[model samples]
Target: MQAKEIREVSCVGAGVIGYSWALYFAMKDLSVTVYDINEESLQLAKKRIHESLETLIKNNVLTKEKSEELEKSIIYTLSMEEAVRNAQLIVESGPENYDIKRQMVEEMEKYTSIETIIVSSTSGLLITEICKNAKHPERFIGAHPYNPPHLIPLVEITKGDKTSEVVVEVAKEFYTLIGKEPIVLKKEALGFICNRIQMALYREVCDLVTRGVCTIEDADKAVTYGPGLRWGIMGPSLVFQLGGGQYGIAGALKHMGPSANMWLADMADFKKIPDEFAMIAQEGVNEELKNRSAEIGNDNASLAEYRDKMLIELLKLHHKL
Candidate 1:
């Protein structure tokens, strides 16, 4: 079915991610059914969903009345059959284990029609293996969202070998319909796209700290005040294109390539992170938080609130909310 034809969607598993997806779908004016096994989880989802709507309201994402109206639009269910029977698309955000995911897929297949498109929210698992035993494998796809999918706009769509091209397109368009930025993966990747880029940069930070080049807090400051600001507006390549002046990116690379290569040579190459780094990183984060002002948040709870508020403002600048 076409993207526009998708009116009813099911979110299988009412954990944080699943409930967030349900909230997003409802906000987009789609009929959403959230399914889970336990009643407590569903109740918790209801509470979180209400709080999330409040966050959106505070961010000016919607008016209070509109939030209330759509808040009641979501239908929560315990039976998988009741959830998927009428859904044109299903987003399974079940446990990230092979056994758990495979079991969910088998159960979802039983209730969902063969023509219904089902997508996994698996971050690192290969879509090929996840749907390998599916009765309707062609209809399965991977649509990994950034954390708190309702707030974040990016969704990475990947297709398994058995997935249909049409399914991929529909998934992309469906995410677009909900005001999200959706990117299709040309080939399967372990960390997909953003995660790999994030980890690569993070690895360099770890290396710099371990070598005494900079402290963890200083590294955070560098990213926050430097390239991170620009990255929010434009990608790195485009920023470099500007840095190249009239010469463009080619010239920038040509001039910087030698130094970049030397740095890359000195960068961390270990497949596994140094185990001692975790404790050190935690200590660094504690110090960093302690150094911050009350306005910016000096603790975890307040810091998260600051982050959400800041993210809303950024998303506003980009016209996402």
Candidate 2:
């Protein structure tokens, strides 16, 4: 069935991701049932969700009227059977433990229809390995979203080994219908797309400090102010393509190839170094956050409001933002 026809969705686990998923689905006008085993945690999840919606409204990102409607559309439950019984799409976000997921899937399979689409929000675990014995493997897919789901727009939609092309297509359409920038994974690989790239950069940052080339603060500033702005617009490859007549690696090969290769080799050899760099990186991050935590929290509300206002201007400027 098409995603537009899906009217109800069930979210398993009432943790951070679960609450975010509930708000996202409810905002789309879909009835959502959020289930969890812990009664107290579930109450906290409900309270957090309402407060988040209020924050969005205060920021002018979500309307108060719409927020009320979304609250009404959501229902909290502790019964797994009740949550999945009528849901057309089930998103599992339970603990990362493999045994826990296996048990949850085992129970859900008995209740959900064969046609229901089951998506896991796991970051790196192999879905094929986890759901190897699931009843309907074709309907199982990975719908991983980044942290703070309300702010991040990217969603990685990956299909397991036995997942059909139709399942991938439907998942993409489902996410897009809710205004997510979902990308379909051609096939499963370790860390998928974003995380792998993230790790690569992280490795280099570690190496830089290990070799005494720069302090952790310097590396952080380089990425946050330098490549990060361009990355916000496009990937490294596309960014280079627009850089004067040079196109990606070809241009870099002619201009900065020697330096790039040197760094690559340094990174390879630097991995065997001592733990000083790791300590520095960790301390640097902690110190920076410690200095800014209060300021960040103080302005988070107003910043979110400004963000929404700018979004309206952005859409007008681009005519499609």
Number of clashes in every candidate structure?
0, 0
RMSD of 2: 3.5
Instruction: Please provide, for model 1 over 22-91, each residue's C-alpha lDDT reduced to its tens digit, 9 standing for 90 to 100.
Output: 9989988899999998999999999999998888898788899999998889999999999999999999
What TM-score goes with each of the models?
0.98, 0.86
Best candidate according to lDDT: 1
Model 2: ten consecutive residues of lowest lDDT: 312-321
Error of 2 at 31 (Å): 1.3
Candidate 2 off by > 4 Å: 246-249, 268-278, 289-321
Model 1 spans with C-alpha error above 4 angstroms: none
lDDT string for model 2 (132-249, tens) is 8798888988889986565566899888789878888888988888777899888888788998888778877787776778877688779978998678666788776666274555
Q: Give the best candidate by TM-score.
A: 1
